[model samples]
Target chain A: MNAVKAIFLKELRVEFRNKQMINSYLILSLMIIASFRFAFSIIDFSITELASPILWISFFFGGMFSLSPIYKREIEQGTKEGLLLTPISPSSIYFGKLFANLFIIFCLELFILLLFFVFFPVNIPDLFSLLCIIVISTIGITALGNLISAISSNLSQSEVMLPVLLVPVLLFTVIMSSVSVTSNVFAGANIFDVLDEVRLILAFDVVFIAVGYLLIDYILEE
Target chain B: MLKNKLRILVSILAIIFILISVYFALIYTPPHEIMGDVQRIFYFHVASAWISYLAFGVTFFAGVMYLKSKDFKWDNIAFSSAEIGILFCTLGIITGSLWARPIWGVFWRWEDIKLFITFVLWLIFIAYLALRANAKSRTSKANLSAVFGIIGLICIPFSFGANRIWQQYHPTILVSSEGSLQPSMALSLIISVIAFTFLYIYILLVRVDIEKMKEEIDKLKQKVGG
Candidate 1:
């Protein structure tokens, strides 16, 4: 507990101190949401149709851009080696990175979601459920992305490679559930309607975290 | 070498089997009563789908074995199978989309959960291939990729079920039950599936051999230079 908390705090402090990734995430999220809003300024699709895809796409892509720096910075600074040798459980390192990533991505998505409603005036029928979807999907993405970033951090051109690797992982399962829940929530469906998707998102987060915990050791093997 | 003879034999057999299957498909099987001649593409489409699954199946098992054993040969097999799987998956998706254009009136349908999920699976494996490409060392590549392969296999169930769980209201594009198949269509489908399986094995054999040869050359280079 202490090790994971220490690592988590350390990563959080370092990230806030730099704020480079956080700023870029904000800009990218705004750009995606704003551009799509403009592109659809004429069509006028329902909030259920337009806002859901735009919201999820912006958040996923925005967080995707921010994700690589979680590990890429470590690899770049030669600090990943020091972190690995810290006598902490490897899974603690994985969870620490995952928690940090989940925090950044969740905040970025929340910003995009808020900006989305601000621009479009789309009413989310269930603000609480929408938040649940965002938080669940963010957990899933962060767990998967942190591991993928670790795998690709040692590779050249990790920024480009991260999305190529992360998008596919998200596409089939997590993104689908997130989009489903978001769509249903905006469509004014009853909460029961979105429960299945919520469960799916929850399950995916567990699976991703488990995969990371078991495999991070092998990935960091030197 | 003995392996050379075996390769030639498999290559010739694959060629002959594919020829016979095409002949049967074109000349032997009857056209659909409803969809007409565009239905002929079904023979190859279904076969390609199965072969793609077969390729990924090999990758999945080989990947698991590689992780357990730490043998590069298993990694080689996984890599070879994944390469073959992606090719066949592309073929399957293209063929399905082409079939969809005339029948479903759209080249792509969001409601068609099977094709959409297949496309997603296709995307995931493409990422798998990229991971394999980005690794600097053979062992690391094997290690990372094997983990991904396991995850991909786990996702298969959800991909198969995504449509049913998502919307009870959407249309299922393909309906195949036990009694839906006419005898001639069934025979033709089986023949083509067998032929495609042979082709898959032949291609994978060639790819694995090439990978092995590359490794041997690298080994020889290190021996001479180092």
Candidate 2:
């Protein structure tokens, strides 16, 4: 736990110091949300009808931006081996990075959700339930995102490879279920009303977290 | 010599079964009462879908074995199976679209869970192959793509159950208790499936052999360069 905490803090400190990833995330989120808002307005579809897909698309794009740096920076800085040499287990490194990425993603998602509501003006009856859904859905995204970023970081073109690798795996299961639940919430359905989708997202998070934890060592193998 | 003979036998058998299956599907089976001749696409569509799933399943198993044993042979098997899986998956999607155009009056339906899930599966494996191409080292390629192969396997359940789960407009042809498939249609479907399975095995055998040969050539190049 301490090791996980230390790594997590180190990640936070680095991000806080440079703010490179967070700044990119903010700009990227804004661009996605703005472009989407314009696109929807041109189409003249009810923003309320299309709110969830647009929101999740922004999250997905911004989340991908944040995740790419998870391990790519360590590798580029030639610090991955040094981090591995530490007494900390590989799973600690994974969880620490996952938690760090989750923190960043969660913040970005809340900001995007706020921006979404401001631009689209969709109503939600239960804010807390929506927040819960966002947290769970983001967990599912980052849990797999961090691990996949670790994998893609080993490749020559990590940036290009990250989305290509991440999108399809998440689209049908995590992203789809998240969109479903979020749309339900936006449609005035409570958390219980969308329990099935929420449960699917939860299961996706658990399965990928377990897979990532068990397999991180292999991906990190020298 | 015996391996060569077995390969030829399997190849010939696959060809013969496929021809027979086509005849059964096109000529032997009665035309659908409602849809008529275009329904023949069903046998091939379902068969391709079956082979694609089986190929991915094999790839997943080979990936686990590669990770467990750290054997490049298993890596080769996984790569070969994934390639074949993508091919058959593409065939399945195209056939499905062709069937959908006349019947559903649209080439594709985004709202349909089964079609969307299958397309997603296709996208995931294409990414798998792309990752394989971009990887720098043989070991890294094996290790990383093996992990990816396992991750990709999760799509199988959602693909298989998409029609059932969402109750989408995608037809539940074979599995329904009321038996939508007549006896002749069932025979044709079975034959088509067996033929496609044989073709998968034959292609897999050839693909694995080619992969092994490529590894050997790489080893020789490294030896000579050193």
Candidate 3:
């Protein structure tokens, strides 16, 4: 537990100091918002309906882009080995990395969602439900991303391979997130409407996290 | 020697079965009232999907075998199976698109759960093969690939369920709310299933044998060098 916190805080500090992850995420989100705004200005469609899908798209691709630096940076500095040699369990290391990545992506997602709402006239009937969906879907994304990024960091083409390996597996998360958000936007945040999507995301997150934890020790074995 | 003989036997039988299946698919199976000629593609398309599933199942089994035995042979089998699975899955997706063009009036739609999931499956295995190619050591490559093979197999169910849960338009193909298949199409599908399973087994055996021969040649080369 202490090791998990230590690693988690260590990663958070590194991420904060470097600011690469947050900078890229913010830039990409702004670009997506700008593109959509430009396109919508020409074509007359209700921005409210499009808000959820656009927000999810930004988050999904942005989260994917953020994965390279998470593990690749550690591997490049040879810090991964040093961290592994510590008394921390591999699962703790896995979870800590996962949690940190999730936090970064979740924060990015929330910011994008806020930006989308400001730009568009989307009204959330239930803020709590939307937050739940966001957190659950983000877990699913980061859990799988953590595992694949760990694998990719060791590969020659970590940059390209992470997305190539991840996008497919994480498609489920992306689809579910899109569906949940879309339903919330169009249908007034009915719990029943988004229940299946939320459940699927939650179930997938749990399963992948468990699998990633069990396999991380072997994956990190020298 | 016996194994070689058996391989030959299987190959011959597979060839015969495939020829018979194609004949049945083209000439014997009556055209559907709605889908017409395009429906014929379903025989091959569905067969390829079956073959893909069978290949992945072998991959999953061989993955476990490699982990348990730590033998290079099982790893070879797993790799060969994944290769075969990817081929069949590709064929499946292409045929499905061809079928969809006439029926759905669109060749590809991301909303279709099955099509999307199948594409993802294809990409996952392709990544697995890429990982294998880039690894530095043989043992490390095999071990890593085996782990990936198992993890990818485990992911299939979630992928499938996710698609289904989203209420997408992709045909479930295997069970219906009302009940079983629609008789004629079901029979034709079953025959195609058998034919494709035979094809899968034949291809797998040939690939495994080729891998074994390559290993033997590598051993000979090492012996000469030493």
Candidate 4:
């Protein structure tokens, strides 16, 4: 408990002590969202129907792109070795990174969600359900992202490699379920009607996190 | 060498099976009542799908073994099997889409759970290969991809079941033993499956050997540098 909290605190301190990452991420996401506005400018359909996919696409990719450096600093400065030398269980390290990723992504995604509402507003029939979708999907995304970034952090080209590896495997289930719930809500479906997608996202989060937890030791093998 | 002789035997055997299977498929098997020559694709299509699953099964097994024994040999087998699995999986998807277009009036069916699962499964293996490519060290590549290989195997059932969670009817051909297929068609299907399985084995052997030779060259390079 103490080790996990300490590591978690350290991560947060590193994250906020320098606001460079968050500031850049905020700008990057807004730029992508603006470009999307231009890209869909010529489409004939109501932009409201396009809102869910756009929101999820920008936030998901933005969250993913922001992750290219999650472990780079640790790896480059040999800080990961220092942490490993401590008596903290590797699973705790996994949890610390997982939580940090989940928090940072949620913040970034919330920023994009607010921006999206302004550009192409859709009445989210159930705010609670939409929140559920965001929270669960973020967990699933970061769970997989942490492992992928960990895998790529030691490589020569971490930036290009993470997405090529991460997108295909995680994108299908996460995007499909997230889009399902969000679009259903946009179309004024009741929260009960969206339970199936919610369940799928929940189940995906559990399975993904559990798998990452169990496999982290193997991935970080000496 | 004895190994060379065995390779010759296996190669000859695979060739013969493929020829006989092709003959049985096109000539010996009678055409379907509702559909004509196009149903012939079913033999190789279903067979390739089955063999692709088999190749992935070998990969899953090799992954488990590598994690247990930490042997580079098992990693080689896993890597080769995944490559072969992706090839056959792609063939399966193309052939399946071609079949769907003629009969179902759509090139792809989102409602068909099997089709969806096969597409996702194809994506998973492609990602597995991409992950393998990104790893810098030989051991790390093997270890990381082995972990992913096991995870990918677990996703097989989930991807198959993913659509079933919404709608039940997925149009499975596995339940075809109830006299739906004629005796001649059954025989052709069996022969096609056998041929493809042998083809899988032959390719696996050649691929693993190539991996070994590459490793040998790498070691020789290191020795010269050292």
Please provide, for model 2 over A1-222, each residue's C-alpha lDDT reduced to its tens digit, 9 standing for 90 to 100. Answer: 999999899998888788665787788888888898788776667655688788888889988988888798899899998998888889999999999888878888888988887888887788888899889988978998898999999999889999999888876667766776777677788899877667777887898899889999999986
Q: Give Cα distance to truth, residue B89, candidate 3, Å.
A: 1.7
Model 4 misses residue A68 by how many Å?
A: 2.0
The model with the greater TM-score, 1 or 2, is 2
Weakest lDDT window of 10 consecutive positions for candidate 4 chain B: B169-178
| Chain B only, TM-score of each candidate | 0.91, 0.89, 0.89, 0.93
Candidate 1 residue runs with Cα over 4 Å from true position: B1-9, B165-180
Itemize residue pairs with steric clashes in candidate 2.
Answer: none
Taking the tens digit of each residue's C-alpha lDDT, what string does model 3 give over A1-222?
Answer: 888787789888998887765787788888887777777887877655666667676777777777778777887898888887787789998888887887888878877877777667677777777777777777877887788887777777667777767766676544555554565545575556667666767787788888888778766765
Local accuracy of candidate 1 as per-residue lDDT tens digits, B108-180? 8766666876787788789899888888777878998888888777776655545555564333645431235
Where model 2 places Cα greater than 4 Å from the true spot, the runs are: B158-179
**In model 1, what lDDT does residue A190 have?**
53
Worst 10 residues of 2 chain B by lDDT: B169-178
DockQ of each: 0.48, 0.57, 0.38, 0.37
Which digits, one per residue and each the tens of the lDDT, describe model 4 over residues B1-226?
8888877888888899999999999999988876678888989999989988898899999999998999999999999999999999999989988876777767887766677777777887888888887788888899888987887776665454446543422244432312268899999999989989889988999999999999999999999999
Q: Which stretches of candidate 4 lie over 4 Å from their true place?
A: B1-9, B161-180
lDDT per residue for candidate 3 within B1-226, as digits (tens), equals 9988888887887788788778878888777777777788888999998788778888878877887788999998999999999999999999998988877777887766678678877888998898888776777677777777777877777777766655542343432212234576777777878878877888888999899899899999999999
Model 1 over residues A78-105: C-alpha lDDT tens digits? 8988987788878898888788777777
